[model samples]
Structure formats: structure tokens, C-alpha cells
Target: MKFVKDGASDIGMKLHPFTLRFVDDQAYLEEEYRSYYFSESISSIRITLVLAIFFYAVFAGLDVAVAKQYQTQLWLIRFAFVIPVLVLLLILSYRPWFRKNVQALVGIGMYLTGFGIILMIFYISKIGLYTYYAGLMLIFLIGYTFIRLRIVSATIAGWSIVLTYEIVALCFAHTPTIALINNNFFFVSANVIGMLICYFLDRTNRRDFFMRKLLEVERNKVKAANDVLEQKVQERTQQLLETNVELKKEIELRKQYEQERTKLEAQLMQLQKMETIGTLAGGIAHDFNNILTPILGYTEMALEEVEEDNTLRFDIEQINHAAVRAKDLVQ
Candidate 1:
């Protein structure tokens, strides 16, 4: 989900993704892209600058060595070719300011234009122009690939290929025989191969991103499901606690009932003992009453027979009184 703006002469060429822009903040997106752009630009600039300087020095030394032995036109052409590369290096060195602009296209255009000019000059002078052309295309591809501008990089690569083949046809058109292939042709061919490799790498990165996002989504789903399950477990645990409490209450109730039953059994035993004592007391009272009645009759008969003997009658009455007291005790 990105857009790529063509940095060359085509000002309107843009590559837009077929998706919604979820990033709501334009400033944030711009800043993020700018950081990446600058980082890559700085690295590329340093590398190209160092390489350009190195080549220039080497070419200058060779030119000096073969000044009298080789063509003057060749020396002058090689020397002129070095100037544009140096200018490109200078422009790329000021990458910080380039990021402050409205868009990255401005900086990209400046770089591409500088590189294009150098290659054009080299081609006209016939000084390994094919190699520089292929290198220029490679630079464009690498820049876009790192900065998330795939479409534009592809477009630049396509044009570079078309132009390279045309230049190749012209350069080797009337060659007598092939002794040693020109370094320019080899350089351009290698750059195309590198571009293909870069394309595959970009594709692999995109696939990896898709897979990672998918895994993240699945992980979130599992987390959500686990949360629900934990909630259910918590609810079931609460129910178990309530049930356990109820069971304890039931056990206490059973213990209370058992205690009441024991008390009732003791009370029943006491009642049975009382009933047996009442029956025994009634039987003893009846027997004592009969005996006392018999004693009273005998005493009365003795008193009547001994009317004259008052003392004997009194003694018999006392015996009947003592018998009555004994009857009461038995009752």
C-alpha cells in the first residue's frame, strides 16, 4: 500500500496502490517516507561519489600515461565525463535539504537528470557509455527499491533496457571482429541482471509482509477466544463456591436433627421410667390400705370384749394408730 512518483522528466507518472489509506496523518506518512528516503539517498550518494571519484582518478592517471600514445579526443572525452559525475556527487551530498521539499520527486529528478547528462556525454564521446548507462539504470532501480518506489523503478529500468540495446546496436554495428568485448556493454548487461534480482527480492519481501500480518491476525483471534474461555471458567468457579456453601448448610442441618433425635430418645426413656414407678406405687398403696383396714377391725373387736378394761382398749387403739402410720409410709 504505497505510491511512487516518477522522478525523471515525466512529472505526472505515479504508482498508487489499490487500497484504502489507513494512515490518517499526511504529515506522519510524509515524515516516515522522508526518513527512509534520506537514509537510502545518503548511502547511495556516498557510494556513487566514492566510486565516481575512484574511477575519475584511475582514468585521469591512465589518460596522463597514454597522452602521447593514444588519441587526444579520447583523453578529453574521459576527462569531460568526470565533471558531470562530480556534479552529481555534489548534488547528492546535500540530501538533507532535499527532504524538506514538498515531495521526494524534486530530489529524484535532480539526481536522475545529473546522471542522465553524464551518460549522454559519455555516449556521445564513446567512452564506456553503455556501462555508465546500465549503471545509471541500476542506480534508479536501487533507489526506488529501497525507498518504496517499485513502479517508478520498473519504468526506469524498462527505458534503460530499451535505450541500452539501441546504443549497443549503434556502437557495435560496424565492428570488424570481436577481440575483447567493450566494458560498457558488459557493465550495462550486468546492471539488467541486477535489476531482475532486485525485483525478486522485492517480491519476496512483500510475501513475507503478507504472511506476518496473517499470523498477527490469527494470534489476536486466539487471544480473544482464550479470554472468553477464562471468563466462563471464572463463572463456573463461582457457582461451585455457592454450591459448596449450600452443602455445608445442609450438613449443619443434618447434625441439628440428629441432636434433636437424641434428646427425644432420652425424654422417652424418662417417661417410660415414670410410668413404671407410678404403677408400682399404686400396687403398694392398695396392699397397705387392705392391711390397715384389717388391723383397725381387730383393734375395735378387742376394745368391745374388754369394756371393763379401759387400759387394754387404749393400748389396742394405739396399735391401730401405729399400723395406720405404717400404711401411710408404704403408700
Candidate 2:
């Protein structure tokens, strides 16, 4: 549908006014339509031609039923001209050229088939002309609606047949004025009605094509948006994963820092306790040094008095040794 805006002008035109073609600048879109119309109508075109062949061949029996002046001209018109042309059209359906020009070829085939009926009317006697006129009406119906010719092509083919019939009736065939008027009336009516049918059919088909193109565009946009969303999700997921990993590392580092803080706090507490004990020991040692001074002086005096190889001197010397060791500890 991106093409809908730039590729077509009357993206809004529901029914193409005259040409039944897109704007002149929209050639690419027109070509796309042509391809779509061709492929879609080809099978029907072939089937319609086959039906034409069958029916046209069957109508050869009319020559036997309504012979005028022993005329075999109708038989030649059916077998030699019209049936062969319809068969050629059937064969052309399989050709590459036909894909691009299907409507034109089908229109041409339709016109020639109607013209063959006109020839029949010319060759048939006045007593049996009404039957062939009805055949012409049938051709109009098939060409306009069933053969899938657009309104323009169907109109051209249909009115051209009418014009040819008028000329043949007036100049060559000697048709009475009343009969020609009657035939013209029916022919004109059929052409007008067929035009309407072709118009509606064409309009409807084009609308459907436009809707399908829009649907494709919407689907593409949705897919693109979904792709973007998916990419964003993946990116966000990766970011969260990285953030989680960093968060885990931060948590581990914080725990280690806390543990180190606790260990330092315990070591500081132990050092403070040891320092308090040392302070207490220093005060006690200072007091004890003062108390041991007199004891050391008296023990030395007693040792001096108990000298001269006496057992009393030995005991006094031991007491002096103990008092001196105590004094050194206090110092």
C-alpha cells in the first residue's frame, strides 16, 4: 500500500469515470492491475472461448433448418470464419502476448463472433432472421459479462456489432424498417444493460484489489514493529544481566569490607585491653619497689653480722639473695 499513495492518483475513485484506467502518472499501478486482471481472467477467457466454439459449431444446424435460396453461406461463416477465430483465441490464451492484451483479444474475438451472426442474418431468409438476432443478444451478454471484458472494451465491441447490424440491415440485407427498428431497440437495450453489468463488475474487482494491497501493507508494518520490539527486549535483558552481575560484585565487596572492619575493631579492642593491663602492672611494680627497699637493706646487714663460716650466715645470705631478686623485679 506504500504504492497506493505515490503510485495512484484516484486511490479514492470508486468507479473510474470514463477510461476505467488509473491516472496517467500511475502507469506502474496500471500495469500491476493489467497483470492481475490478466492472470485472473485467463482461465475464464479460455473457458468462454471454448463455450463459444461449442455453441457456434452447434448452430450450424440452423443452416439446414432455415435455408434461403439454398444458401450454404451460413455454414462457411460458422466453420471457416467464426469457429476458427474462436479456436485461435483459445490458442492465444496460452501465448505470452495474450497476457498483456487479454481484454483486447477477447473483445476482438467477441466482435468477430457477433459479426458472424450478422452475416448469418444477412444470409438467412427473412422468415428465420429473428432466431439469429436472439443469438446476437446472447453474444452481447457473454462478451460484456462472462468474457471478463472491461466496460470500455465491452461497450466498444457491443455497439460496434450493433452498428454493423444496422448497416447490413439497411443496405445489403433488405430488412423491413419495422424489423430493423425492433432489432435495434433490443440490441441497444442489451448493450446498455451489459455496460452497467461490466461497470459494476470492474469497480468491485478493483476495490477488492486495493483492499488486498492494504492488508499486505498492514501485515508488513506489524512484522517490522514486532521485530523492533523483540530487539529492544533483548537489549534490555542484556543490560539487566550486566546490572545484576555488577550488583552481585558490589554486594560481595561490601561484605568483605564489613568483615575487615569487624576484624580491625577486634584488634583495636585487644590492644586497648593489653595497654590497660600494662598500666595496672606498672603501678603495682612501683609500689612493690618502694616496699622491697628496706627489706634488702636489713637482709644485707644480717648477712654481714652472721659471717665467719656460720650456718646463720648461710641462712642470712639466702634471705639477702631472695630480697635482691625481688628488688630487681620491681625496678
Regions of model 1 farther than 4 Å from truth: 1-191, 286-331
Query: In model 2, where do residues sit more than 4 Å from their true spots?
Result: 6-11, 24-28, 68-71, 126-128, 245-331
Compared with the true structure, the alpha-carbon lDDT of candidate 1 equals 0.52
- Which pairs in model 2 have colliding backbones? none
lDDT of 2 by residue, 176-278 (tens): 8788888899999999999999988987877777676667777888998999999999999999999999999999999999999999999999999999988
Give the TM-score comparing model 2 with the true structure, all chains together.
0.72
Summed backbone clashes in each candidate are: 1, 0
- lDDT of every model, 2 decimals: 0.52, 0.83
Best-performing candidate as measured by lDDT: 2
Q: CA shift at 66, candidate 1, in angstroms?
A: 12
Candidate 1: residue pairs that collide: 131-184
